[model samples]
Target: MTLLQAFVTLPVLLPMLGAAASVIVSPRASLQRVIGVVTLALVCVVAGVLLVSADSYGPVVAQLGGWPAPMGIVLVADRMSALLLLISTLVTLAVLVYAIDQRISDYGRETASTTFHPIFLLLSTGVSLAYLTGDLFTLFVAFEIMLASSYVLITRRTSASRIRSGMTYVIVSLMSSLLFLTAVGMVYAATGSVNLADLAGRVGMLPEGLKTVLALLLVVVFGIKAAIVPLHFWLPDSYPNAPAPVTALFAGLLTKVGIYALLRTQTLVFPQDHPSTLLLVIAAVTMVVGALGAVAQDDLNRLLSFLLVSHIGFMLFGLAVYTPSGIAGTALYIVHHITVQATLFLVSGLITRRTGTVSIAQMGGLAQTAPHLAVLFAIPAITLAGLPPTSGFVAKLALLRAGAGATPAAEIVAAFVVLASLLTLYAVARVWVRVFWGTPKEPLVDNDPNDELVVGTARSARGMYVGASSLIVVSIVIALFAGPLSAIASRAGDDLQTREAYRSAVLGPDTAPGGPGPVPVAAVPQGPAAAGGGAAIGAMTADDAEGTTSR
Candidate 1:
């Protein structure tokens, strides 16, 4: 095996090992933080190396213990996997810092300080492995790793409210896991193997009805994980109940994992299917539903949670189209959304820290008192709103441009996307007006006309803003480098569409899984953005909460 091939496993391997090390030193919080940060930082470095190797020499594939494909566990890294690896690692690191601060500063709440590092590291291990694994069951294992750790993290806060929400999350996640396992069983029973390369060929050859059935089963499972409409009810409740750091982590990475699986399976298993049409309908509904839900929420975290579901629809739009532009756009959007979403949540934590609540009506003129926080909030607020020159705008423009030339169905989906974008702006704008702008006004009516309002003493933690602002800077960096990033995304999209190189890379050029010849290496494509083809897309950030009590 080549050196690069060997390097492909480090992202998962290093983190797993580091988690063990962190556990050994778990009694020491400072040491644990150092270990966690160093370990994940190294993981990021390895991921960058793998990304460079993949970009230079097609998809990198490494078989575990020299076991061959379809039998041995395999690791594969291409532009997409590598890109996501970097994103996930960086986000986890930032959130780790934020979480550490929360544990230290918010001692009023229960914080599992000792177990946090190990569990968080394990969570990173799962996310890394999920991106790298080339076999279906291995992906399943990866999911469990993440889910198990997530269960602990979400339930770390011992309040009755959090426990109730955690139970809901656990039940829903268990159900999705069952669905995923069942779908895999069916796929294995039909295809005779579970390796992605093996299934790639087998999936295409299945009878039309079976193919559609299999695809939809997989879609439903991922749909739940991704929080698609009708399946997203758990998010608004479960997410907001977690501590702010956990909320940020779950919001940024968890649903995206579901989306990542969908992307992988969509290209490898059903490359030629017209499922995008169905996805378009779901996308339209998801967008409207999520945005409207966001509009109706008074809890800041819950409002963000609904918006999370809505934006997933945007990514769905790109994936549904099955074109180079569509996939690239989706990829870019995922990255943008992750950073901006995390930034907003981090800002949410900062706001709550100062005001003791996320209720907009209880908040009074944060802009005047905390100008630095206001500035931090404003950057991402505008970025998330799809304002000009921000990465969000660029990503949306790419999706719209791609859809503009697609089928009539795609055109209709595009209209819904535009409507959702405007509505998203309004939702964030409302937050700006209610939370950051005017006075903190009390309600005119109350429960039994006797409700009481509690105002918290505003306080600032030393390192909290540091961690939060880092993510805002990340979002800004993404916007600034939209061109190169889009080109890379375009290349990944092309590679996904041209599945030959991937299977051959993993299964070997000589014994390409489904073919009789050597796998041909493919070149990365330069995106339309390289030529400045579309209108400049910019972004803004927003989130808000308002109370419904009496004065």
Candidate 2:
């Protein structure tokens, strides 16, 4: 393997190694924290290098076990995947710091030992693997890794309510995993290959009915993960029950990973020539439903969770358009949302620290005493609402431009986009009025000792602030660099549309789809071939053999 190819694996390998090391060093709280932080920091740096390499030199392909694509595990760091990886690693690093500080403040340095660091690193590894994997089966494994780690994180130091909510989360996640596995099986059964580059060439050749079923099945599976609309019921309950930092990490990374998978698979395996009417309608409904849900929520985390679900529709809006501009817009929105959503959740953590309650009704006059906190909340809130001069506005504007097409579906969904933004602004404004603008109120003290409501020591609070502010700065930097980022996103969109660049990167120029010899078509049954018979099976097998021999 070349140097660049080897570097791609570090993001995954380093974290797995670090997780094991963290396990061995368990109960050494300081060392575990350093290992987790340093591991993520290294990943962040590696991801940055990958983004640069991919943007400048095309995709970085690493075929593991010295095997080739369509046969062995492959990791491809394309422009899109590399960009998302960098952002994810940075967010994970920030959330880890915040968690460490929170732990120290709530339960001293010695008590901050055991399962947390290892599991968190494992989750980071899963996230990196998910983005970099070049096939479906590996992606499933990555999801399982993340789910296992997240389950432990959510239920770790919890009350009865959190445990119950964790159960809901686990159950829902397991169901989606089963569906995802089934989809992978169906795709492999039909195409004889699960590698994305291989599937790119073969899936289109399947019977239209069978292809459509597989596509929709994959969509539903990812939709459950991404928390879009009707599938989003588990999120608000599940996320709000977790500790602040864990909620922030999940809010930012998990759903975006789901959306990334949707983008990668839909564009590669089930290429759409025109805007999907079904997706557009779904986007519209999700935006409205999630926004309305947010407006109705009394709890701060629950409201933010609803807004997270609502904004996912915006990203879906871009995918629904199925054009280069639309995809670019989606890419930009994903970057913006990942930063803004995580920042909002982190800021929510700070708010809870001060107010000692999740209810907006119980919070008041924070703008008077904690002006800095107000500033932190305002920036992300304005961004989340798609207001002027922010990353959210830039991303939303791109989507709007993409949506101004001749199609009626685009126009209708565009309207819903605007409606959702307005609702988001109103919801945040309500929080501002209730939580910041009113007369000062004492912190609400709950009887539950396990309730995640504590104002930490000044030093620890400073650590938490630093963590949250770092991401806030990141969101600002995204806004500042919107022009270049948008350009990069446009290029990424073009790459996805073309498909050949990715195929060549992973499968080698000689073996890439449409290169050398006839493209291998899967021996899937159709029409009379569907009937069970030795002759038909033998005929299909013979055809496949001929195709393989020709290659």
Candidate 3:
């Protein structure tokens, strides 16, 4: 295999290997920390190289087990997946560092537990698989891996309240999984294959109603995971109760992974010539509702969780526009949100360490006492609010420009974007004035000593600050280098919308969608009717059935 192909698998494989090694070296906290850090750093490097290669050479394809796509496991890294993977690895690395320090600070150096590092690495593995996998079934498997690891992380060292919240997260996640699996079965039944490039060709031949139903089904499945508006109820309760670093990781990567799935599948299998009106409406409602929810929240983490839900609308809005510029805007927004949201959550953890409370009303005089922490919080806070010269502003501007065309639907959603940003500014400014500007308040009494997030001392916060600050610097750099980054995002967006390059990369050029080449006899159904709705209604011949694999 070529070096680029090798780079494609390393991002996923390295984390899985790291997780296993961490488990074997369990109970040795320091060594495990080194392994986790080094593994993630290497993955980040690989991801960066993959991004450059993909941009220069089109998608990088790696067929595992020496089998071709639609028959065996396939991993494809295009500009979109490569960029998201790179950002995810970097954010997870920073969060892991903050988590390591928090563990040592709350417990001790030798007392830090073993499960955290392994489980965290597993979470990163799942995310890598979700982004890199070239088939729908593999995506389902990736989501399951992520859900399993998250279940353990959410409930680890839990109190009754956390257990209750974790249960809500689990039940909702399982329901989504079942729905996702059902959708996969439906797609396989309809298209005779679940390989994304294969389906990209075949799904277009199905009846319009069936295709629409499948598209909506996948949207609902991913929407629940992305925490978009009406589907986001479980998130506010579930995320805030976890230890801060875990919350940061989830906020930064989990929902965005869901958005990535939406961007990937909708553009490939369910390509639309016009912007989707239904998606646009959902995006507007999500933006308005999430911003309003944040305004009412008193707890710092819960408020940030609400804002996380709110910004998901921006990504959705970009997708709903269904233009290359819209998709590019979404790409930029995801990168910005991943870094800024994670930084905000980590800084919230630092504030909890210093003040012993997450309640915005209860925190006071941080600007005067913990001035460094206040500065740390302010930068991300303003970025999250989409103020000028930050990554958020650049991303939002892209979305606005994309939606600035003649369509009323795009115009309406663009207005909602502005309203949401204004509300977000108000909500975060309230946090700033309430938490950082008032007379100093004493630390809240440790009502729940079992909750490590609010019970930790600030003595060992230097590493935590470093972790959070690294991302803060990343967010700022995104602003400073917005031109090149925006160019990359635009190219990635064009690649996603075009679909030809991706299909060519995954299923060789001979079998790429729309290519002037012979179709795989097993891929196309027998008759004209069979080629259309025939497959959906059991039109596959015995020989064809024997030829196709479950993947």
Q: TM-score: which candidate is best?
A: 3
Instruction: Write model 1 residue lDDT over 449-480, tens digit each, in one string.
Output: 11111114354466678888888888889888
Residue 471 in model 3: shift from native, Å?
A: 0.5
Instruction: Tell me how many clashing residue pairs each candidate has.
Output: 24, 0, 0
Q: What's the best-to-worst order under TM-score?
A: 3, 2, 1
Q: Write down the worst ten-residue block by lDDT for model 1.
A: 538-547
Off by over 4 Å in 3: 515-523, 526-536, 540-551
As for TM-score, the candidate ahead, 2 or 3, is: 3
Give the distance in Å from residue 104's predicted Cα in candidate 1 to where it truly belongs. 2.0
Give the alpha carbon lDDT tens digit for every residue of 1-551 in model 2: 38889999999999999999999999688999999999999999989999999999999999998899877899999999999999888888988888888888887878755688999999999999999999999999999999899999899877788889999999999999999999997777666667898788776666666778999999999999999887999999899888889999999999999999999999988998899999999899999999999999999999999999999999999999999889999999999998889988988988887777888998899899789989989999999999988999999999999999738879989999999999999999999999999898887654565555454212335778888999888888999999999999999999997788899888789866563222544343431244333445434543554555566
Model 1 residue runs over 4 Å out of place are 108-112, 273-275, 440-457, 513-551
